[model samples]
Target chain A: MMRLRELAHARTGDKGDISSIAVIAYDPGDFAFLAEHVTSAAVAAHFGATVRGPVERYELPGLGALNFVLHGALGGGVTRSLALDAHGKSLSSCLLEMELPDPQAPPAAP
Target chain B: MKTVRIGSGAGYSGDRIEPAVELAEHGGISYLCFECLAERTIALAQQARLADPDAGYDPLLSARMQAVLPVSVPRGIRIITNMGAANPRAAAAETARIARRLGFGGLKIAAITGDDVLDIIAAAPWKLMERPDETTLALGDRIISANAYLGVEAIVQALAADADIVITGRVADPALFMAPLVHEFGWDMEDWDSLGRATVVGHLLECAGQITGGYFADPGYKDVADLARLGFPLAEVRADGSATITKVAGSGGAVSLRSCTEQLLYEVHDPARYYQPDVIADFSAVRLAGDGPDRVAISGGRGAARTGMLKVSIGYRDSFVGEGQISYAGAGALARARLGIEIVRERLLLTGVRTSELRCDVIGVDALHRGPGTGAMEPAEARIRVTGRTDSLAEAVRIGNEVETLYTNGPAGGGGASKSAREVIGVVSTLIPEAKVTPRVSYQVT
Candidate 1:
């Protein structure tokens, strides 16, 4: 339900190590909620890494959405760890899986 | 049921029946496309960046979002569009955002980008060959927007990703809708004939409802009924990418040879060979037959092997320009407007500044006697508009200032400066051969 931009941020490390971590919101409105509650510091805390620089936010008018770009990470060998050939891998899918949360538990019946 | 296609423009307005939309709703259409790029669009996108650096995607897609998504999705009608002028990624994101906001969160959106190669033009290894039409291959300098008109590959990829919406930038207009159908139907990628049929469908519908009646024969054309509820065409290709074109029923517009052929020549430079990123579709073999008042059938499309290269789009710094306008009233205004143009041109030349392009037209006054012909004018009033381009704003300003002189003792207005000058920028497009284009695919999910 959430726009891709609103739920994500991506940045590459000094050696071109790409690391992105975002909290996928289920509802479009919930993106605003995540943006409000999930601070960059919180994200850095979750990843156990130092906040490299100010998170650069993007309000994509053309796309009618928002996104942020964060830098630096605790470790840099995510791609190398895969050890899979680049042509055969779908990194975007892997990254997306990491960013999105499993379905939340249903609320108790009233 | 037979296949039908329709094409429209970028940033569609649901306020009326866009031809493409109309065809899809009323006529039994199978495909819908909208070609929204022009020389001015890149400039508009650039200026939009000035307003908001993240404004590369076309705003017009918003118009198509609410209207088409609900109906098309429910009906299993697939849609493809190139409303992603400068940034397909942003366009796709915006589309998904709108869908989610509207409670249609299940829709998956795919954005195709990285076709822009503005940075590497200086060192690209391609020959930068010239076309037979005397258009030179873009040098590192002359390039304004060098976006490769991608074929249907990315669209196919999006469909493989199970995306509900696919947005692309500067794709060959026909490929917008063709790629998705071919992919969804599991059409063999190597089946050139099937690809050609899909390409034909895309071409027919690329101009939206033009395959309907927006730009068709007069008198019989139902401008109001047709105009009020335009249709977006839809194709129902199966595993072979061959399908029928039909709308959801009870929409406006009629699909016929008159309408379809009119759209065929809209921006056509060559009828024999229509160029696109995937393959060269020969329009000569395309056959159209009027099945009914609201149905047009198409088939017999052929395509040559695709050249192995991606077209690249590169935009860079270009000269600035501005245009000024003034309206003259009373007798002799038409003649005066012409003289006014001459005076301005002469003055600018005398000052030793040359403009890249200049245009002059006497609108109302010229319309008076000749009924739209350029001839000896019998007065009334004149409105003069002059467009001049220069690298310097100073030179542009001088050209704008001379208009007031024509109005004073020269043409008609009360002298002194009568119009305002605007700073303009020149935009030119060139194609980069495929060898220089490299796909920059990045993946992420949120």
Candidate 2:
């Protein structure tokens, strides 16, 4: 399986206590697989306790990207959070560690 | 039908100054925009104004003007900026004053104000969206400032009046880019699709160097060239609201599809509905194409009607943050640092110093990932950081004192000890009716 870092690059933004991370594919051809596999549930599970609220994913087919808004994720936002990366700037790189479907695998998998 | 080449000069208040000089010197552009204010910067500036009447604008305002004005003024490049922070009139006056010193006699500077609604907000029983329980009346003297995010109308009006440079208070970041597009292309304020497309261009150009590969480089995976002298971004916006993102040729960094895509998603929440004062831009339909090296063209942005209310950022006195750090090196550094943290924790409890929240982290060990710490291998050194949020300044100073005392009373070989206690400015959001605020542009001719 290829890591999400190989297929996509992401950036994170914070508003209040929420963090929005956007993942965009390097190649337009990989967009379909990323959009299908990288669901809100999957992203939510990846962050786990790092997020206190729900994770919502918005699809941008035109740009071959997915936007994930993680609520209650920034502790108390930038002004208050004691987190080293309080704005969740480094969190995007952590999300990039997500495993993706390997291109060399079988044509279809359940 | 003419295209406007606008270069982004400054992304934030303290961004590098040399890149702007590079843009002004070599980059051929009509207008250069600098975005300097953050959510809490104005509140801090308000505190500064309270201390000294003539010091509310950006501290580096004169320095940046000195660095950029000489090269830019003779080149006939107009400037737009929110470097005004808490005072646009003062910033505008200062820019004109600098122009006179630099012998630019024909420069006209405009200042946009009326974003400050502290009186109106204090009159009503308005509660901030973030703090539903706390009303404006309740905040009382702690309220430092409340400024609404203005749109592109005033900025466009300044440009229309032949102002060489436009300075504003608090404005929506994208609106800074959108104002030029509106003034150049004569695009209607109510045209959602075109406005939406223009907003995309503004958003792409808003953060100076991010779109040009300054913030996107990875060592082995995503390599970028000459990041030290990285060039800022420029957009060639057309009459139809479509634009091409490119930088000065032979400059550092690059403008590729990956860089464009990453910047497009920066600070953006929902792809379909990005709430701007002018319009709700829909970037879902936007497409990106690489025309040539260091060039990316973006189009197909859709927009909805403007929102009835505008967001206001209210700043108030929160709590105080106290921090202390000291490094330990050589044989038993990790163990010594751990002992130091434990002593401070016990000392605070013994002294009955109450903190609302406390965080202790071993810097080299597991501060970021919180994973295995120097497991099998014995490392050279480590640092312990003790941070706490206290209600009072005295209490905050004690938190640092407790840590600093560790150098003498607790740990061995603890060197480079430092301590600081600072006030925290908290920003809350509220919505004010669009009609409640009137953005007015006033200009001075030198």
Candidate 3:
């Protein structure tokens, strides 16, 4: 179960629109797996419709982790209509799904 | 019994490290926190293994808690401390043993670890965006030790478990005091205002009566009645987390605004955002009020969300350092000391043995008097300390032996100089990041 979200009129004056998020995964290891799979290109495609800036890496030294910083996303210039799943866990699921290898199976053992 | 009291028992010597027990048995306080770790304490403990295998553990640390732990277990008096350095589980097991020896059974002992992060620096894939010293770390080898300064939740759980003692690794100084306020008051984890009050209390009592006059010197208390019987601080916290700091009767030292302020600012920078594992307490919001006779009431503190990860302490055997000093007496002794330094330097250079670092100082000459003046120069001597870093002990020993040659070949005796200088064992300091560390906990019944 996963979901996406949309906030139209919630604006933070002069400070840029704040994006509050909660990233969840079933297995604790999957959180790390998703972070590893979601490269800059993958992150851009996930939020591609709206954000128009560079993806910077967040070095979380304390927690032994990293986060991708999505810069210049909310300034009113892209497709605002975004689709979401039911449980709001879609973002992390989408990132995790990218970790799955292509199903073509190397053109057969025959 | 006084309305408010805070402090450790001063008379208890070694093997009596339990400040909390003394405070409760005699001081009559509401809250108690025992602070045992220092910046280089863990590293020093590691090095002490070479001298004595059993020196790793502070034996006195356990004896302090023997008396009050049983009394506080049922009554719910909280005890928090960083007594779990290097080996927390062993300490926890020792506590349990002490409890059972006293016929206190079924005591729950929870050991909270995961604060040691020395290994994290090695496994880290990326570098920190910023460092305190701004020095670029080339590899993980730079770290010597890593221990996290965890919050009081683990101690709080141990308290909730009806444990006789809550043993923990190197938690923040304030967390030891804060945990009880959180557990007893049942304050919300995110409640900044309430947490701030607890934080303020922790700061006031962290140094054990530092709020009174342990560190600060007051004109009125220059000769505080009894120096030997000084009292430690006791914090009586309210439901809202506001606390009053005071000491027991018949104790030495005076608590005043000046003294409390001096203790508050000690070893802390940026009161606006003092950091811990849980919250960034704003010390600026706190107001200190002295109500006379060793009582300081603290209120109106605040906090912000924590911003960064906790840093750790690390150490390792990088090199050997040996220092030798010779005291020269009578006139021109300082000149002889200066000549001694030149003699050692040139000799080492000639022998093709360059030391990693060398420091030499001539005391009593320029120290008591100015430059080489017309006056009778006092008895002085040159002290030369040479330290070398090498994988081989033989090489370090060779450098130490080289010091004797300087005496005969160099300038003769000034005025009854000391025989030889002392050898200085080197203990290097290193910082550990929070990610690579964890504490291990265990227990046993005495």
> Which parts of model 1 have CA positions greater than 4 angstroms off?
A1-110, B1-34, B39-53, B70-79, B125-145, B217-229, B232-253, B313-316, B349-357, B364-373, B376-381, B413-446
Q: For candidate 2, give the lDDT of residue B58.
A: 88
lDDT of 1 by residue, B1-446 (tens): 32233333332323243544444455443334556664345545655655775687666678777676655665545556667777666777777777777777466666777566655555553443212243324344554555666777777776677665666666676777677566656666667767777777776665555555554423422232555565545554544444345443566666654355444433333344556677766555556565555666666677777766554433444454555567766666666678778887887788886787665555553221112123554656556766665777777676667765665545556232344444433333355666666543222232
* Docking verdict class for candidate 2: medium
Model 2 residue pairs with clashes: none
Quote each prediction's TM-score: 0.65, 0.94, 0.64
lDDT of each: 0.52, 0.87, 0.52
Error of 2 at B199 (Å): 0.8
Worst 10 residues of 1 chain B by lDDT: B365-374
- Runs of candidate 2 with Cα error greater than 4 angstroms are A99-110, B132-134, B330-335, B369-380
User: What DockQ results do all the predictions give, each relative to the true complex?
Assistant: 0.01, 0.57, 0.01
Q: What is the TM-score of chain B alone in each candidate?
A: 0.78, 0.96, 0.77
Most TM-score-accurate candidate: 2
Computed on C-alpha atoms, the DockQ of candidate 3 is 0.01
Task: Put down candidate 3 lDDT per residue, A8-108, tens digits, no spaces.
Answer: 00001010211212222323344454455445676566655434566554332222223444445433111111111111212332333232333223645
Q: Rank by lDDT, descending?
A: 2, 3, 1
Best by lDDT: 2
